[model samples]
Target: MAKAYANPDVLVSTEWVAEHHQDPSVRIVESDEDVLLYQQGHVPGAVMIDWHTDLQDQVVRDYIDKERFARLCSSKGIANDTTVVFYGDKNNWWACYAFWVFKLYGHAECRIMNGGRKRWEADGREWSREPEPQYPATSYVAAEPDPSLRAFQAEVLKHQNKGKPLVDVRSPGEYTGELLHMPDYPQEGALRGGHIPGAISIPWSRSVNDDGTFKSARDLEKIYVREAGLKRRSPIVAYCRIGERSSHTWFVLHYLLGFPKVKNYDGSWTEWGNTVGVPIEKGPGGTASAEASS
Candidate 1:
């Protein structure tokens, strides 16, 4: 028997998305690491939200401001009560990231399309290359950013010092001092390799099955609880290169496993590895030391 997720309502199937994507009260959003993938064809009626351009501030490393987030939602025809469904490529990697961002803005109703684009295509669903349809702009209001869902560098350091758990959701190469980024990736985001001191190495993709759907709650518990020793009640922090990969883990921990307090470190390795004076750990031995001078 399969154990149920802590919050199964947060995940909608590709079939469910297929049926409800066109409904006026539902907004289907496709967010991908490859910003151009949506143009190639996507779930019919799905709108594109480029992770780089639409969600991020151009001049700063932060997300868009509340007013800009409201305008973006309004332009996308999203009302405060509308159910926003996020889906995309790479097992919904960027989809989960976008979902996390929406939560930070206090969006009341948000869901992820399980299996995302991979399953959508594998299921033989139809895709459309037609121009994105624009609905009437809505008067969406965004709430102030939620501090609990996000973690900054200083907070993360303090959390580490307190012996709290931090999950490093990157490839093992990046987790060790072997690589600055994922294999075959740019290898340029940070000045150094290795992970934040005391973080546990758990690649983000382990939470998902081959079809891109998340694994069952029982299986998830085996990985996170039984093996990794994560408790449901404890606060945790997850991070990847720039936080996108860790968002996937954040969803699994917080929503699926019912963890009460979990934060995504958006600054991630980019900030930690580049900044001076922070402590880092190298190799599987997990020794902590001050970051080396560039």
Candidate 2:
């Protein structure tokens, strides 16, 4: 078995949460895309924070800027001592992403829900209909950047044809150039309707079950190790339309499997898929984007 963290350090079950709702050390954060879903109903004592708005820096580079992210957590009353239990309606992927952002900022006290809110509700967990905004005053300190935790375009290009893994979480159609959104003005350096030269395909949806909860670590290990030939120790870069989906995977690798060097290409396909000239490989047949050399 892999080295799993203690209960307080990792994903806690809905039942466990119920038992600790009033515990001052624990805090539940609802990181849903649709605020209405959380506002309408959420686990008791849970507070809402739209993953898109409340969590990320969401500008160019598509990462959580350290200073801003730290302040956001502090603003939400999350402190170094706060043991976060993050859950969301979207299979908990975004929740995991949010949890990852905090970890990137050097906060190790956070945990994401195994399945997410849907499973919690399915299991008949007690919930609330009221919303309470949290504003806490605490200082969060961010340490050195975890360079191994991310990748940039230059690094990705170097590994393109060498079979170095850069997992694309986009749909097959998008990866194959069948439905890619052509940018308004062709990007200065972009790839056409193809994926990175040596990247593999693992649609983001594969990580989550139909009900939006993450599969167990044991099952995930099988999918990753047997199917992808990747273990917790593998050097992999996960990317998607943006960095959000990949961030979800980053959390899985770092937190669930305790992988140390899994990097997220934050710019992702949104940046690569748009570059003017780059080697691309699509299903059936492939072509290097004319833009690669331009």
Candidate 3:
């Protein structure tokens, strides 16, 4: 059973938030994720960090821009001594995205809210109608972004057409090559899905519950055991449009299941499924289709 706060490595619930919102040790990031929602309202002590703009790497078009990533935490008053609790809608992708960036920069004491704001609102929790003002500027010592947590376009390029299980966590339409309104769905709806030649299509939706919290560990075990074909020794690399969803999955596999080393293709289909020259396998599960370009 996955008790939200019990497993610090995985998740935390709204109840946990209510209980600990004021703890000096715990910092809450509202992760407005969307500009509109942020402007509207948020948790009492929550700090706003725009998921798409503030949290992402604007340059290098790759993993979290190293310098920008470090600055983000410091700006948010996140010090090396702080323990972070991240929450937002978008199926926890917003929270997980920041969580991944924090991990990428060598901080490990972060947990995503199990159900985000939905749970809080559903339970009639208090909602603040205004965002918090910025705090006084304080410099946080920045560290060089760690590379082990990042996987690159070039790395995926080397693996393209290699018959590895290129997992796609995007929606079915995106996978079936349909253009979607949401640009974030899959690298702006770029990949002609089906899937990578030997890839798996496990949309990230299967991983979470209707309430937005993750399924329990036992339940998660069943999903992966049956749907994912995960083995004790299987080497898995999870990907989504621009790497955020896959980072969520990467957290699941690495922290929850204790998988040896689940690499997240951070560029994901954004770089692979959208790029013109690197190969792609467009077909259903493990169909083995490849344009085979050098």
Candidate 4:
């Protein structure tokens, strides 16, 4: 297949992952929603990074601070220059979310393993129970968090006021307020249903294929550009019930489609839906249909 995005290096295929995974310069990180999935079976030499425990602050609703981030990387044998390749289950939902958090700490050498665990297992790739040997911990210092790639509720409100693009990457049921969570899952349900007023529903699943590999750039153009009416220059923010699923879309638009400015509103519906007096829209007629933006 032809190269899709302007900067296509953000993604690495399974074949490429298999070849380079054991390289000293490469570190394979598996971040999954199901915390125990990695222990069941995983890519050889891959280290599991639990999305909840490893990535988030223990007592707060925020991510781990930079100091903790540096420590986590050190424990994982990741240095400032390590090329970290992320892959996992649920179509890389938590994997991409982990990647987004990595970007927050200014890790530049990160890439997502294309097709994630679904494709990896389907291909009958090598799996292992043996742990990859960890390199000696290096003194790693995380860079200052990049505010540009993340969105706060204030910025999301501003985007709404300005009529800018806000992509709701949740399922249709959640988007329409008919379901509080993804179809069958009740554990992740939010207090309120419905989407942010003026936000467009473009489920993150549309970004990938049945085999869990992403579609060609041409097809992506049709989905995000033609169907959702997104533009390259426009400021776009994606969100889900939580931030995880939206991070997948953020990767697609920013790294895959090469949009210049894209942010993931990490607070997402969990924050918005519960906040008092936050405007929300429900039902088919609630959201304004997207049209191609200039």
Candidate 5:
């Protein structure tokens, strides 16, 4: 038998989703890097949440304000008490990101569909192209944004300075400063290319199987505990070029492994590599420079 996850309730199988997606008390949300994927076809009754426009603040680098978040949930027919299930393409990359955002706003009942869109498709599940019907507007009062779930640049700096565990979840190229960003994606997010000092290069994909489902808890423990030496109770932070990939790792460590404290640095490399005075280390086994440079 596979070892159980620390918080198994946070993950639901594709079969569980198929049976319960129509439950009036459950809301299925699809978020993807390719924003248009949902319009092509998605789980029936699943609503789309675009990470760029729906979750981000238009003017600032931060997420949307609490009022906007409340309006968004209400518009999506998600009441405070509704159970939210998130799944998406890219191995649920953006789905985990959307889940992180919801948690930032203190949504209590949130879960990720195991294996995401890839698994659902592989299983030959039903898909719908019809536009989702508008749900009745709900009254959703968001709790004050939780500071503990998010890490700012300064907090990340302090975390690293203290030699706490930091997981760099980007591709090795990005981690080693060989490529500024993922290949074929825009290479323009940062001026400098490298990782924060003392960060472990554990690509997010390592935690998931070829089918895009997460590895078993025993397998996960081998990777994160035996290999990476991450402790279940340690405070850790994860980051990627733009934070989406790192959010996936955050979900793994925090929910799957039951780490007591893990935060996603949303600003990530776009902010870290661009900031002039922040320290950056380049190349494999590189040393940190007090000032970042091209």
Candidate 6:
């Protein structure tokens, strides 16, 4: 397939990772929805970074601050210059989320392993249950969080008012207010169904192929630019049930297609749907109401 992405360096194939798994300057991190999967088996030399525990603050809904982020990097043997490659289960959903957080702290050398854990395992690669040796911790200083890449609920509301591009990367059922949560998943504290008003329903899975690797750049161009009518400079915001899934789309548009101004609304539907009197939209055709209760 033709490579059409503007910045293809942000992604690396499983083969590239296999060769560099032992490289000293490269750190392989696995972040997964099922945290215990790393203990069972993971790519050799890859350390585990739990999204819920390591990437996010325990008390607050926000991500970890620079201090905690520094601690995490040192513990993981990551330096400011380490090329961090992330891969995980669920077609790299949590992997992209972790990548987004790393970018938040301005880690400049982050990359995602294309196809994630599934593709690696499917290709008959070796996995190790033994623990990797930790390197001497470095004083990893993180840059201030880049607010430009992230969106708060207030910004989302404002974006809605402005009629800017808003991508709802959840499933069709969730986008239509038919499924209150992901199929068979818990309610996850959302008080209402439906999506933010004026959001375009573009499920994140559409960005990847059946093997979990992202589609060719031409295909992606067709989906976002041609089909969705997005421009290169369009100010776009992506969201999902809790923001994990939307991060995938954020990475694709911002990194792959080189969309200039795409931000992930991390609060997403869980925050939007619960806010009193906030507008919500239902159905594929985008009919909306003042409240999700309708």
lDDT of 2 by residue, 45-106 (tens): 77766666766556744555777776766776777788888888767767877776666667
lDDT of 3 by residue, 148-188 (tens): 66667776555544544455677765565554313443336
How many residue pairs of model 3 clash at the backbone?
1
Candidate 4 regions with alpha-carbon error over 4 angstroms:
1-3, 285-294
TM-score of model number 6: 0.95
lDDT of 5 by residue, 1-294 (tens): 228898999999999999998898999999998988898899999999999999999898889999999999999999999999999999899999999999999999999999999999999999999997579999999988899889999999988888777889888898999888787788546888999988878889999999989999999888887777776677888999888999999999889988888999989999999998988888774223211221
Model 5's lDDT to the true fold? 0.89
For residues 66-183, write the lDDT of model 4, one tens digit per residue.
9999999999999999999999988898889999999999998999998999999888898887755577797889988899999999989988877788999998989989998888
In model 1, which residue pairs have backbone atoms overlapping below 3 Å? none
Model 3 residue runs over 4 Å out of place are 1-9, 136-138, 160-163, 178-187, 287-294
Candidate 2 at residue 113, lDDT? 70
Q: List the pairs of residues colliding in candidate 6.
A: none
Candidate 1 at residue 280, lDDT? 85
Candidate 1 lDDT tens digits, 79-150 = 999999999999999999999999999998999999999999999999989787798999989999999999
lDDT of predicted model 4: 0.87
Error of 6 at 172 (Å): 0.6
Error of 5 at 241 (Å): 0.8
- State the weakest 10-residue window (summed lDDT) of model 1: 285-294
Query: In candidate 2, how many clashes are counted?
Result: 14
In angstroms, the error of model 2 at 204 is 2.7
Better structure of 3 and 4 per lDDT: 4
Assess candidate 1 and give its TM-score to the true structure: 0.95
Residue 289 shift from truth in candidate 6, angstroms: 20
lDDT of 3: 0.67
Which 10 consecutive positions of candidate 3 have the poorest summed lDDT? 285-294
